[model samples]
Target: MSGCCGPAPDGRYSEIFDERFASSIARRYRRRGLTAPEGRIIEALSGLGLHGRSVLEVGGGVGELQLELLARGAAETVNLELSDAYEQQADELMRASGVDGRVTRIVGVDLAAASDADVARADYVLLHRVICCYPDFAGLLGAAADHARSAVVFSHPARNLFTRAVVAMSNARMAIVGHDYRGFVHSPEAMLGVLRAHGLALRTYERSKRWHIAVAVREPAGVRTAPAG
Candidate 1:
């Protein structure tokens, strides 16, 4: 979606957000015994029963989760990214994984410019580490919920002493390095309020160190389950 905002004074953060963060962090989860975060995502999603469903991942960097969802039996995966550079990386990753045909990539120039059609086409939507970057947190959350027919899965930094310390350190380091601090820390309660206003019911939630993960199910009219035997 398109909106007017002051141009970023320096583009270093934008550049870093667009570029791939080397292979080290990616490999850490894949080969270095650091699968807990991925495991957390998998477990949360599995609980929602995503087999044969269409999934949309907003701001899915490099399309890692898109590949994983396709592999895990999601019928199709769509990636909506804000950066052309990252979108290219996502395309490359899909091609390298040999799943290009199963994924769709859309580069959104602005979040506010996204459409209802974009939001309404998915049975499931994921927002991993994306909301924290948005200046309008409520708008982003509402848009995500509006588009999801079934559920929205997300992970972000929690509000706590340790997390506050980390944010302070990050701000200090960014100042030292002539870069903008790119982190957004929100309280769990405030986030829940935004979801509730959009008619999404929280299904599951967890906290890991400074990170918080949550899955919220959309309460549409047609989503009722059959009665138990």
Candidate 2:
């Protein structure tokens, strides 16, 4: 999963995903492998053909999902992160897994605002637990779709009474702690619409108790080129 908090526009919220938080996340991955939601994402992407493909994961913490993709025969992966804290642990994990050469970590770059050169396109794009952290889902998902040549898969809190309450309480706690980070509950239908507007069609939708997993694939050439919206 991505870090617990969203990155501020100025990128000054590094403390939210600081070294301590990064380490804890890394340690958990080392001990427990992918989380349940993350496992679901991998399962969905695996069916889409990962062999020799490249992946770009936005806000990927410790690059665990990328590692899994590599193990499943991905050629390489680029991890874009807002906080630099995850780099150290991600590097250690990559090196320990003997895949350091196949991974690139780009830190402190907001994909929505990054230059084309900074945001490289890939065969598969992933955003595990990222949509909720970003308030502007359109900007984030648009950039993600622009960079994806084949597919985009993301997980977010399901829009419902239970998840809404969770987000509300989480935001309240952040406010109480003086954190600028916030959690959002964007509508799934609207989010999928963003992908369709970018020429990607929704292929799969799955849900657990709290999160919704969505997988969208790029439309074939000369087919579905116009935005339905």
Candidate 3:
């Protein structure tokens, strides 16, 4: 069961995703001018105590999180991106970071197509503002669970009255600007259900204005327990 936004036709979306977004992402992070929402995501993951662990960053736009994770002592960081342009930029950033050996950039691919063995190599998986774009939340969670040995952390727009209003306004604005809207809005309850069905237990979560962020641990099936002794 692949998601509606499964593979973006040709394993890449550079042609569709506005070049301005990529440029904006690079400029903001490079100049240390990330927006409040972006900064919050970085802070949230930083607080996850991820030292000496392997991390896989899905849809890692410009490799900002990967770079930060490496600086925070992650053993290795793998960035899976769906844009060749971003991948090239990420490679350049990794080279400039002097931590090239600690980072691997995989571009022009979707996470769903990755083999279970390849996905299972990570100790932690990060999906920042990426899940909402996925049409099949269930499949996405299942894939994340198969890969993550310990945890999968994600952040997305919260589906509240206020946030819904914001999204509507944003969509209208995008339409006025001649850009196609590309956000998938869902409530936190729906998000949690997806995780639960995939065998992930929520460990911590937080909500801010329109954003809902959570960290979940993977729970394997069929562990025998002694009778309440």
Candidate 4:
């Protein structure tokens, strides 16, 4: 979640995404990755047939999802991040899991800017808390579905008045501070439309007070779901 309060006095908005304090964030990531939200994500994944499959997690800032996917028998996982800040800490966590070689992290790239080779299709693709970070929902999500061989799972802000106020406040503060970081409140129906257009079928849906997760799997062999506008 975007901090309830704006960035700290120390330009933490920028530094938080840089190496300056990545270790601290990484530590927090390690702790929180094992919590309820992540649990729900894993629960949704239980039926994805992830065993020995490949995974790609966009905006997987701290590698938590990748680690968990590996633990659940994913053969390999790629982390597509928008910053290089987590390089050291992310690598360290992988080393700790003894799966360092199987995790490929492409830092400094977002889906809109990533190459086909950079994102090479995987059995499962994840976008936890990532949709709200990037402004281009269509481009980003379209790319996600294109890169997913079997299914795509993602979490985004729930469209509600409370979330609207929080995003508004956060954006206003960031604007005043001259920071480029901003969050979005996109339509779930439209998002489902994008997934549907990709020929993916909605398989499951889960939500928390602030976030919602949608898991869509590719249509069965020889079948295709009609795309929705």
> Largest lDDT belongs to which candidate?
2
Off by over 4 Å in 3: 1-12, 16-18, 33-48, 117-120, 165-181, 220-229
TM-score of each: 0.80, 0.91, 0.79, 0.87
lDDT of 2 by residue, 30-135 (tens): 9999998988888898999989999999988899999999999999998888877887799789889999888887777788877687677999899988888888
lDDT of each: 0.69, 0.85, 0.70, 0.78
In model 1, the Cα lDDT at residue 118 comes to: 45
User: Pairing residues by index, what is the TM-score of model 4?
Assistant: 0.87
Candidate 1, residue 165: Cα displacement in angstroms equals 3.0
lDDT of 1 by residue, 138-195 (tens): 8778777777888888888878787778777876787888775466677677776777
* Global Cα lDDT for candidate 3: 0.70
Clashing residue pairs in candidate 2, if any?
A: none
Each candidate: RMSD: 5.9, 3.9, 5.8, 6.1
Off by over 4 Å in 1: 1-13, 20-34, 117-120, 172-181, 220-229
Counting clashing residue pairs in each candidate, in order, gives 6, 0, 0, 0
Judged by lDDT against the true structure, how good is candidate 4? 0.78
Could you give the candidate ranking by lDDT, starting with the highest?
2, 4, 3, 1
- Give the residue spans of candidate 2 off by over 4 A: 1-12, 225-229
